[model samples]
Target chain A: MKGLKIIVLAKQVPDTRNVGKDAMKADGTVNRAALPAIFNPEDLNALEQALRIKDNYPGTTVTLLTMGPGRAAEIVREGMYRGADKGYLLTDRAFAGSDTLATSYAISCAIKKINFDLIIAGRQAIDGDTAQVGPQVAEKLGLPQVTYAEHVDKIVKNKITIQRRLERGIETVTAPLPCLITVNATAPECRPRNAKHLMKFKHAKTVTELQSAVEDYYKLHEDRPYLRIPELSVLDVEADTNWLGLAGSPTKVKAIENVVFAAKDAKQLTADQKDLDWLMGELVANHTLG
Target chain B: MNNIFVFCEIDEGKIADVSQELLTKGRSLANELKCNLEAIVIGSKLEGIESEIAPYGADTIFVADDKRLEFYLTLPFTTIIVDLFKKQQPQIALFGATSVGRDLGPRVSSALKSGLTADCTSLVIGNHEDKKEGKVYENLLYQIRPAFGGNIIATIINPDCRPQMATVREGVMKKEIINKNHKSKVVAIDVNKVVTDVDFAVEIIERHMEPRKIDIKKSQVIVSGGYGVGSRENFKLLYELAHVLGGEVGASRAAVDAGYVDHARQVGQTGVTVRPKLYIACGISGQVQHTAGMEESAMIISINTDPTAPITKIADYNITGDVSEVVPRLIEAYRKHSK
Candidate 1:
């Protein structure tokens, strides 16, 4: 089997699953410490799909790529812990506050520089339920896209067969190679972290450590030194400078108003003819019984 | 100044109510922007459908009827809309953010290279209304969409693009009453614009009849249970209560995660967002994500054991106690009072 390069798109979102009523900050932003760090559920599902493809086909290497703060490297190690061959974190202060459009541009640029056959991503991040990044990435690449995919039925050579989840039912779709797939939660659950993988990549670090490792490796083994996934500099990718973040983003935040819920109190009216008739009138007026 | 197009969705030969809702909304947008609102219907034998849409206030109906369109295919739908968009050049477009809309909106918008916002709860056309830098165009229409999962709202403008598009979720707007006597113009377009390919690798084998037909969006009242409901077995009581209330049953994300219900009934960030007249939350702690869907409920009732549960703070009537006790009592109260 040929060595197949696979890239999985990962994102760092605030741990919204654990956010309580008071967990939100005064500014409407989530308090980071109050929220725990865990892989986005769908992204984990995406990695699960990637690992399945890797396991089914020999000589396949899975690479995790993400653009976020240095803390997002934790997701890369998470990928490693889940059996990915390598992980790459694309972090720069300049790439902040990006909407889907700008975010897709950055990802597509990074994808063009990598050698890969498939790009698997969670259908959408929990924090931003837009479900746009995968499809937008596909548009940027000009490839056929399958969103809300439940499972991969078969991968016969270059053609991949999948079950695309529909609203009431599911449809089986087969697309040619080099296509992007956004895995919904239907994929098998990602495996628990393997202890051996944790020990192997426990030394993974920030770009600084990664760069320093390259120099150390160069001095230690002149010909065959260990090479981690390289940190891509801005110049290495074709991301349009104007479209990098907020500037390319045509959307501007108008406001953030926290929503509060208050329940209504209404005693049930008895089934007497007059009372029932009046209640019926109210329900009909309110369109609750209509 | 121009025409705004809306995709009129139809199901089982009847124009889906959301189309009328879109027309009601599109009417306002067209009125605000000083343009004609055009309703586009694409399906077989939909001749008099325009009659139904007229009272809602569509100035024109672009009808493209064909057998191929009877059942939706992504390719044909996208191709037809793309062709129509190229020719009509509407200033804006709208689609219902349904399962069908979610499936079609992105493909159509991408094919046209036009901007599209999905699942918007609100629509506010910028006051810039009629800004034309040149006779060709200026003062572009800015479409505002909630971003970062509703953490903040963002205003989006497509200066160089034609026909700004948005897929609004159902229940965000109300449908206008259909009046057969209402007036509108009809323009029939060629249906054979694209070569129809009947061969699709995927086949729909069978559809198991869903035991319960619950369209959460269409349900007027929703009885939702949460983690405080205790266990999956308790959900039967929630179902009983909902049945007695003559409403559909729903669940918080917590209950769904606990394996109490299907994803369809789960309401929240990852679940369905619903706006009902009477939203009864049983044993559910109100989280922002969970509240996003039901906050718009005309009336909310929280029955939970925890007095300080988040649901209690926002509840109009908070019955602080175990749902196990309160729910049965509420059911009895409803039955007793009604009897």
Candidate 2:
């Protein structure tokens, strides 16, 4: 029997957890460059899940995909160094400043160009924590989504069994294959980078990807392979131009505000009978209790 | 008139209480906008669910009932919600940031190609002068959420989208009073997706349902263990206290990681955020990331060996004593009081 085909969705994010002079701004948008860019921690956990399944199932091919600026090719290449059979980087100038909807539209377009038996993503991105893009991509792809997944327990021939962690407890559910899952950190920690695999993909850059390498080589040795990321036009991924990036995205930001959290000096609602009566009345009056 | 669309979360045929809380908030938002509020429930066997929503202030109930939706897999649920937005455009949409909701809200809004703000802590009506008169909203939708690790609040607006959406954390608001037989219209939207069109090949096997564990997020009373609880096994004191209070067991993320309980019960940035009525923090030194989740409790009491524990700063009452001793006493007090 052939192994499962798993594809992981990963994002390159500013390591916001790295607190330094460069992490925050005077106005509060993240100082993207102050912190080094790293693969999202949860997305790494997502990648690890795919790798573990491959290790257990054997014959599995794991593919990783991302859509971002050219720098994201490094994250995909890093995934390739982690046992991913192939990595697709959808790097283009047009995909910048995308909100969740626009980002999902672009990634979904990219996924359509590949065949996969399973799709996985982190539950939420660390920077935004909106937790929207994964499910949004699943919706655009018209796939079943099992979110807040903490562990993958068993796999029958065509049915997949897994544990979904909820606020209260865990629910074991069985569903058919070809679904999307957004995993949480409670899943297994990501495996460390492998050495041999890293060496194999170190030279695995596209022609465009190697262009920068040549420039850097010109600067240093001027002899080594010049590397530049492969920049895919919307046509390269077979994506409909009408439905990619901002043009295909429908949601638009109306405004953005910075809110300050100030603790209020609140009086306690007493447990006395008189206080209880007043509280009950207040609850009912406020439509909290009837 | 402007109408608010409330996404009422139903898990295993039961309506999640957080969605009811959202209805209460939505009702007020709808009133502030001077429009009707519709409670949207998607699931199978949803006949009596609408009866329980009206007291919370729903004027109309939208149901997308189907067997495929019996379990929440994003596809079927997101499709129905998008269909509703297309058919009956509402000015504002609100959802609970539960596992299902946090996943579903964005997908539906995006599918309809609209905007959504996630993990919102509050919402208000903005001036609708931007829209021409006779439009759905009196002004605009003001979506608010805690951003930057819950340190900063952000109010985001989607001026172009029909229904500006937000997903709020649980217990941030009080649940609306539901009148059993309030009169409301139930509209069934026929939203369907094919089984074969999905690209992700995932399978579901037997669900190894975790035996019923305490759900601290929904509990009105929580007996929580903190760092001073000493060891993971010492969490039994929290369970004893919770049993006496007829409440649920909870913990600081520290306690959960100290091997005191399963990670599912961890409460903090990466764990569940809860707002119970009475939160008893025993032996905890409250950090911002941890307190950000539980700060909204109705009444908070801090018990720590150290009088200067950070939790004491915000606690309504403080008991400075060893949690190993104080928790047992609190349990005894609850047991005697209840009996």
Chain A TM-score across all models, in listed order: 0.80, 0.77
Q: B1-339, model 1: which lDDT tens digit per residue?
A: 357888988766877767778888788878788888998887888877877788888888888898756765555666678788887889888888775676567666655655667766556565333233433335455555544444344455555556777777655565655455768889887877553553222233323323325678766579999988889898999988776665778998889989988878998888888887678898889999999988887667777666777776666666656677666666665554431
Candidate 2, B144-197: lDDT as tens digits: 665554434455667666678888876566565756557888777664542333
Q: State the displacement of the C-alpha of residue B102, model 1, in Å, after optimal TM-score superposition.
A: 2.6
lDDT of each residue in A213-280, candidate 2, tens digit only: 64443333233332223456577766655555544554433343433222244234323344334433
Name the best candidate (by lDDT). 2
Against the hidden reference, what TM-scores do the models get? Answer: 0.70, 0.70
Tens-digit per-residue lDDT, A30-78, candidate 1: 4455556667789889898888888888898999998876677888888
Question: How does each model score on lDDT?
Answer: 0.70, 0.71
Q: Model 2: runs farther than 4 Å from truth?
A: A19-31, A153-159, A172-177, A204-209, A214-229, A238-290, B64-69, B128-138, B178-181, B188-205, B208-339
RMSD of each: 9.6, 9.1
